[model samples]
Target: MIFLMVELMLGVLISVAFISLLERKILSLGQSRKGPNKALFNGIGQPFSDILKLFSKEYFKFSVVSMKFYYFPPLFMIILSFLSCLIFPVVGGFLNMLDELIIYYLCLISVSSYIVIYMGWLSFSKYSLLGSYRGASMIISYEVFLFLLILLMLIYLLSKGQLFNFLTFQSVSGLVLLIYFFYLMFMGVMGLVSELNRSPIDLLEGESELVSGFNTEYLGFMFSLIFMSEYLMVIMGVLFLSGVLVWFSLLGYFVCSLIIVMVVFFRAVYPRIRYDMLMVIFWEIILPFALMFFF
Candidate 1:
């Protein structure tokens, strides 16, 4: 088990590094700008350089009265992010370890809410607090829709006498379910973007408004942990959003990469959605339609 976990950790780290690089490249290509290309081999080694630079920096902590709250969130973010990744493959095999595996994974995914809330509240800065509140509200709202969509997906999968795993989702067969599936995927991807605090919905880290949001005060190695956590969540979100497409096969990876590209595409194309508008979209538009679709 230890060896397996070590292997998984290394694999996940490598994947995250490359995904970050690819995301930068994709964004640059999309926006018609030069991306990371300075470190080594046309910036192929940028991720490694980033890792080294972050490690070389000293960790900084805010002088919060409560030491416990100040330090725990970033560590919590890292731990839960990795756990969420591990739970993916083990979901089908470890039913005894967790009674409701999907719920368990959802908790792991959404636990970042607490971290966000804490970073906002615990920090003395009003910007962090405000950003955290917005982040928390947005995440909680969309998470409900995300959970329901997953349940709906499981039902649809089961109707075909399939297990509730992505491995069971073959290429689309029928038109009706396919349409329904895309609708659900649309909801899922939107929820994922909200969860990761990505563009158009990235109110928490609105640089123009809050000057970097929750982690505004964090610098050096401390900031890297927060940054890395977000990227890890991106990878985790891609796996969750891809769902049945996340198999141990070539097709599965292709599908996963395609979905991830769509995410980056949103970053390139869309402007940030206003906080109030985001709330209306989720509570009014997404939730109502999801309820209707599920029933």
Candidate 2:
């Protein structure tokens, strides 16, 4: 168990590094620029170098910030992000050990939401506070749709007596079912992307307005922790969706990579949508489409 857990953590860290590199490269290509080419193997070593540089930097905290609150939120954020991976059913059947996977996941998300608000408030900065407010609103907007979709999947799995049995779920298919599955997958991916505050919907870090969002005051190791936690969540989201959409482990990996690439593509091609338009799209369009699935 210990070995598996260690392996999982290592895999997650390495994956996050490469995902960062991939995103930088793709975004650079989109802008007609070469990104991270200075590092070894055509910038393959860039992420690691960046991580090392972040850790080597001097850490600083403002005098007005409460030491406990200021320090704890980033740690909590990263820890919760790590715990979110437990439901993935990867390595040594860790997920099987948990009976209430969905409940656990939802709980983690709820707690992380509070942590985001706390991180912003602890900074005692107007920019951070505003970002937190935007982050909270964006999270709330998509979380309902995400929850409904997950609940729908859970109900289907329960009715089929195949809860957590993703392989079996993928095997039972038809044209209608395939189309429906793809639709849900699309919705799920968008929800995950929005939930993670990725590009196009990244209102939290709207540099034009929020000035680095909730982590504006964070620096050095602290900032890196928050940064890493975001990417880790990205990997977790991709893997979870892949498990639901594909059967074989190898195929699931391919699907995960494909999804990550798709996310990077969106980040490169699309400009951030306006905040009101974001809320309207979710509340009026996406939410209604998701609700129709229940009927």
Candidate 3:
């Protein structure tokens, strides 16, 4: 049983990794280029190739970039993501200690923004430095909404029935569940989009302005880890957001996964938003709804 739990985690991790590759393939198709056909199933093996490259990468010490703490961002990000995953209640069984799990999830997901900021500031480039400020500001802006959204879902959950583990929320009253579902779904999508750092809200790292943004100084593996974590966080949001037994709740993930992939593919198809426009949308649109939904 313990082994099965480990296996389950590994399986989902593998699925998340594949999802990243598929996003790349779809993006390639969007850009009028054939994506990785060298690997099985048009680059199914690319993830492994990426892993190999990541291991082979040599860390460079730039005069401007801080080598001392360069390891903390990705390291903490990885630890946090995995730590959050462990508390997600696999197999829906009796729990030994669920309290720590909740705290772990919050701490892990909450500090993720710091990882982005750290990467940006540590780069020591003008672009990276500025990008760090923007990224942190954007994260701070959305975090209030994110917390309010979660609180709203909890309120609806309480109305429906007992507040147990994540999966238990699936057993709520039909009407309440539907309401909770919609609220959670939107918040999850919002979280995913924020992590992606792209337009409609790409102010964090507007590459045209920041010259590759936070990742300007990172090359090879460092760059890959930062990028990988972004996608991973999004996928994690999708998976965790679906942590329930309801068929439609799980179904929402399929829809979200499809939309996220398609959106990523057509990413360049849309024009970037102005930085200030991002602020307006977040403040006027998302925050108001978030505030009202919670209250």
Show model 1 residue runs off by greater than 4 Å: 59-61, 90-99, 161-180, 243-247
* Full candidate order by TM-score, most accurate first: 2, 1, 3
Which should have the higher lDDT, number 2 or number 3?
2
* Candidate 2 residue runs with Cα over 4 Å from true position: 159-179, 244-248
Shift of residue 191 alpha carbon in model 3, Å = 3.6
Per-residue CA lDDT of candidate 1, range 1-295, in tens? 6566667677888888998899899889987999999988899999999888887887555565476767778888888877776655534443324436567777787778878888878778989988988876777688888888767766776787865543343233122233656776767778888888888788999999999899887766667778888888888777655544455567558767877888888998899988889989999999998898756
lDDT-sorted candidate list, best first: 2, 1, 3
lDDT of each: 0.75, 0.80, 0.64
TM-score of each: 0.88, 0.91, 0.81
In model 3, the Cα lDDT at residue 181 comes to: 55
User: Ten residues in a row with the worst lDDT in model 2?
Assistant: 169-178
Q: Least lDDT summed over 10 consecutive residues: which range in candidate 3?
A: 169-178
Q: TM-score winner among the candidates?
A: 2
Residue-wise C-alpha lDDT for candidate 3, range 141-251, written one tens digit per residue:
677666665566566667766664555543332234245456545554655576567555666667779888877877777666666666666655654544543235665
